[model samples]
Target: MPHQQTIERKTARTTTKFTGEVTCKGGSSRGIVKDLSAAGICFQLYFDINATTGQEVSIKSDEFGHLTGVVQWYRGDKIGIRLNVSSNTSAQISSYYKYFR
Candidate 1:
Protein backbone atom coordinates (compact mmCIF):
# COMPACT_ATOMS: atom_id res chain seq x y z
CA MET A 1 0.00 0.00 0.00
CA PRO A 2 1.14 3.51 -0.72
CA HIS A 3 1.68 5.92 2.15
CA GLN A 4 -1.13 8.41 2.66
CA GLN A 5 -0.46 11.99 3.68
CA THR A 6 -2.79 14.16 5.67
CA ILE A 7 -3.55 17.67 4.55
CA GLU A 8 -4.74 20.41 6.85
CA ARG A 9 -6.26 23.84 6.26
CA LYS A 10 -5.56 26.04 9.24
CA THR A 11 -7.59 28.99 8.01
CA ALA A 12 -8.93 30.09 4.65
CA ARG A 13 -9.21 33.78 3.86
CA THR A 14 -10.59 35.86 1.05
CA THR A 15 -9.95 39.43 0.01
CA THR A 16 -13.15 41.43 -0.18
CA LYS A 17 -14.47 44.98 -0.31
CA PHE A 18 -17.25 45.73 2.10
CA THR A 19 -18.20 48.48 4.47
CA GLY A 20 -18.89 47.51 8.05
CA GLU A 21 -19.81 49.34 11.18
CA VAL A 22 -17.56 48.41 14.08
CA THR A 23 -18.68 48.92 17.63
CA CYS A 24 -16.39 48.66 20.61
CA LYS A 25 -16.47 49.97 24.17
CA GLY A 26 -14.54 53.07 23.26
CA GLY A 27 -16.63 54.07 20.25
CA SER A 28 -18.00 53.10 16.85
CA SER A 29 -16.61 53.71 13.42
CA ARG A 30 -17.19 52.92 9.80
CA GLY A 31 -14.59 50.44 8.67
CA ILE A 32 -13.76 48.79 5.42
CA VAL A 33 -12.95 45.10 5.67
CA LYS A 34 -9.83 44.31 3.72
CA ASP A 35 -10.23 40.58 4.08
CA LEU A 36 -12.10 37.89 5.95
CA SER A 37 -11.28 34.34 7.00
CA ALA A 38 -12.69 31.55 9.03
CA ALA A 39 -10.26 32.41 11.79
CA GLY A 40 -10.05 36.17 11.59
CA ILE A 41 -10.81 39.46 9.88
CA CYS A 42 -8.81 42.58 8.91
CA PHE A 43 -10.13 46.08 8.45
CA GLN A 44 -9.13 49.71 8.26
CA LEU A 45 -11.10 52.28 10.21
CA TYR A 46 -12.07 55.65 8.84
CA PHE A 47 -12.64 57.15 12.29
CA ASP A 48 -10.82 56.51 15.55
CA ILE A 49 -12.72 53.81 17.38
CA ASN A 50 -9.89 53.43 19.92
CA ALA A 51 -9.85 49.64 19.85
CA THR A 52 -7.05 47.69 21.44
CA THR A 53 -5.78 44.13 21.53
CA GLY A 54 -8.11 41.61 23.19
CA GLN A 55 -11.02 44.02 23.01
CA GLU A 56 -14.32 42.42 22.04
CA VAL A 57 -16.20 44.11 19.24
CA SER A 58 -19.03 43.52 16.79
CA ILE A 59 -19.13 44.42 13.13
CA LYS A 60 -22.21 44.75 10.96
CA SER A 61 -21.80 44.29 7.26
CA ASP A 62 -24.25 43.86 4.43
CA GLU A 63 -22.67 40.71 3.07
CA PHE A 64 -21.93 38.87 6.29
CA GLY A 65 -24.32 40.53 8.67
CA HIS A 66 -22.98 40.82 12.20
CA LEU A 67 -19.80 39.20 13.43
CA THR A 68 -18.16 39.35 16.85
CA GLY A 69 -14.47 39.07 17.47
CA VAL A 70 -11.54 40.08 19.64
CA VAL A 71 -8.83 42.41 18.42
CA GLN A 72 -5.60 40.48 17.80
CA TRP A 73 -3.25 43.11 16.38
CA TYR A 74 -3.04 46.48 14.71
CA ARG A 75 -1.00 48.70 12.45
CA GLY A 76 -1.99 52.35 12.36
CA ASP A 77 -5.74 52.44 11.69
CA LYS A 78 -5.86 48.90 10.35
CA ILE A 79 -6.74 46.10 12.72
CA GLY A 80 -6.73 42.31 12.78
CA ILE A 81 -9.33 40.46 14.77
CA ARG A 82 -9.73 36.85 15.76
CA LEU A 83 -13.31 35.80 15.31
CA ASN A 84 -15.46 34.10 17.91
CA VAL A 85 -17.81 32.03 15.81
CA SER A 86 -20.08 29.05 15.97
CA SER A 87 -19.74 26.17 13.53
CA ASN A 88 -22.44 27.70 11.38
CA THR A 89 -20.62 30.98 11.21
CA SER A 90 -17.38 29.21 10.34
CA ALA A 91 -19.13 27.42 7.50
CA GLN A 92 -20.63 30.69 6.36
CA ILE A 93 -17.22 32.29 6.19
CA SER A 94 -15.91 29.38 4.16
CA SER A 95 -18.86 29.59 1.80
CA TYR A 96 -18.40 33.29 1.32
CA TYR A 97 -14.77 32.75 0.43
CA LYS A 98 -15.60 29.91 -1.91
CA TYR A 99 -18.51 31.43 -3.80
CA PHE A 100 -18.23 35.17 -3.46
CA ARG A 101 -14.52 36.09 -3.24
Candidate 2:
Protein backbone atom coordinates (compact mmCIF):
# COMPACT_ATOMS: atom_id res chain seq x y z
CA MET A 1 0.00 0.00 0.00
CA PRO A 2 1.08 3.54 -0.69
CA HIS A 3 1.97 5.29 2.53
CA GLN A 4 0.62 8.68 3.45
CA GLN A 5 3.15 11.46 3.57
CA THR A 6 3.37 13.55 6.70
CA ILE A 7 4.17 17.22 6.76
CA GLU A 8 6.44 19.06 9.11
CA ARG A 9 4.72 21.38 11.52
CA LYS A 10 5.21 23.04 14.90
CA THR A 11 3.72 20.27 16.94
CA ALA A 12 5.43 20.37 20.29
CA ARG A 13 7.47 17.25 21.00
CA THR A 14 8.53 17.61 24.59
CA THR A 15 11.59 15.66 25.66
CA THR A 16 10.76 13.53 28.61
CA LYS A 17 11.94 10.56 30.66
CA PHE A 18 9.20 8.54 32.26
CA THR A 19 8.65 4.85 32.89
CA GLY A 20 6.00 3.21 30.78
CA GLU A 21 4.91 -0.14 29.41
CA VAL A 22 3.91 -1.21 25.92
CA THR A 23 1.77 -4.20 25.07
CA CYS A 24 1.32 -5.55 21.60
CA LYS A 25 0.65 -8.81 19.76
CA GLY A 26 4.21 -9.95 20.23
CA GLY A 27 4.31 -9.24 23.97
CA SER A 28 5.15 -6.44 26.39
CA SER A 29 8.16 -4.54 27.60
CA ARG A 30 9.16 -1.71 29.84
CA GLY A 31 10.29 1.49 28.23
CA ILE A 32 11.06 5.13 28.79
CA VAL A 33 9.23 7.91 27.06
CA LYS A 34 12.01 9.78 25.29
CA ASP A 35 9.81 12.37 23.60
CA LEU A 36 6.11 13.10 23.27
CA SER A 37 3.76 15.20 21.17
CA ALA A 38 0.04 15.60 20.73
CA ALA A 39 0.25 13.44 17.64
CA GLY A 40 2.92 10.88 18.43
CA ILE A 41 5.50 9.55 20.86
CA CYS A 42 8.96 7.98 20.72
CA PHE A 43 10.21 5.66 23.40
CA GLN A 44 13.26 3.57 24.23
CA LEU A 45 12.54 0.04 25.25
CA TYR A 46 14.30 -1.76 28.04
CA PHE A 47 14.61 -4.94 26.02
CA ASP A 48 13.92 -6.46 22.65
CA ILE A 49 10.33 -6.26 21.51
CA ASN A 50 8.59 -7.45 18.38
CA ALA A 51 6.65 -4.32 17.54
CA THR A 52 6.18 -3.39 13.91
CA THR A 53 4.57 -0.74 11.78
CA GLY A 54 0.76 -0.57 11.98
CA GLN A 55 0.68 -2.77 15.07
CA GLU A 56 -1.74 -1.69 17.75
CA VAL A 57 -0.24 -0.95 21.13
CA SER A 58 -1.21 0.12 24.60
CA ILE A 59 0.91 2.32 26.77
CA LYS A 60 0.59 2.98 30.47
CA SER A 61 2.35 5.71 32.35
CA ASP A 62 1.89 7.67 35.52
CA GLU A 63 1.76 10.99 33.75
CA PHE A 64 -0.59 10.31 30.84
CA GLY A 65 -2.58 7.43 32.21
CA HIS A 66 -3.56 4.89 29.56
CA LEU A 67 -3.10 5.49 25.86
CA THR A 68 -3.77 3.49 22.71
CA GLY A 69 -1.53 3.97 19.73
CA VAL A 70 -0.31 2.42 16.51
CA VAL A 71 3.31 1.67 15.88
CA GLN A 72 4.58 4.03 13.24
CA TRP A 73 8.13 2.77 13.09
CA TYR A 74 10.75 0.90 15.06
CA ARG A 75 14.50 0.53 15.05
CA GLY A 76 16.50 -1.54 17.49
CA ASP A 77 15.23 -0.62 20.93
CA LYS A 78 13.36 2.49 19.89
CA ILE A 79 9.79 2.72 18.73
CA GLY A 80 7.66 5.58 17.49
CA ILE A 81 3.94 5.52 18.03
CA ARG A 82 1.19 7.54 16.44
CA LEU A 83 -1.31 8.00 19.21
CA ASN A 84 -5.02 7.43 18.88
CA VAL A 85 -6.23 9.89 21.44
CA SER A 86 -9.37 11.82 22.12
CA SER A 87 -9.60 15.59 21.79
CA ASN A 88 -9.34 15.96 25.54
CA THR A 89 -6.19 13.89 25.61
CA SER A 90 -4.70 15.79 22.72
CA ALA A 91 -5.35 19.07 24.53
CA GLN A 92 -3.77 17.69 27.67
CA ILE A 93 -0.69 16.64 25.75
CA SER A 94 -0.38 20.03 24.13
CA SER A 95 -0.75 21.67 27.53
CA TYR A 96 1.99 19.50 28.98
CA TYR A 97 4.29 20.42 26.15
CA LYS A 98 3.56 24.11 26.51
CA TYR A 99 4.00 24.24 30.27
CA PHE A 100 6.86 21.81 30.65
CA ARG A 101 8.83 21.89 27.41
Worst 10 residues of 2 by lDDT: 92-101
Q: Name model 2 segments beyond 4 Å from true.
A: 1-7, 91-101
Q: Candidate 2, residues 4-43: lDDT per residue as tens digits?
A: 9998745767789988999999999999999998888898
Q: Write the per-residue lDDT of candidate 1 for residues 1-101, one digit (tens) a residue.
A: 99999866478677878898889999999989998888888999999888999999998887777889999987899999888969867776766667666
Model 1 has a clash total of 0
Q: Each candidate: RMSD to true structure?
A: 7.0, 4.7
| TM-score of each predicted structure versus truth | 0.81, 0.81
Error of 1 at 2 (Å): 41
Model 1 Cα displacement at 101 (Å)?
3.0
Clashing pairs counted in every model? 0, 0
Q: How much lDDT does each candidate structure score?
A: 0.85, 0.86
Judge candidate 1 against the unseen true structure and give its global Cα lDDT, from 0 to 1: 0.85
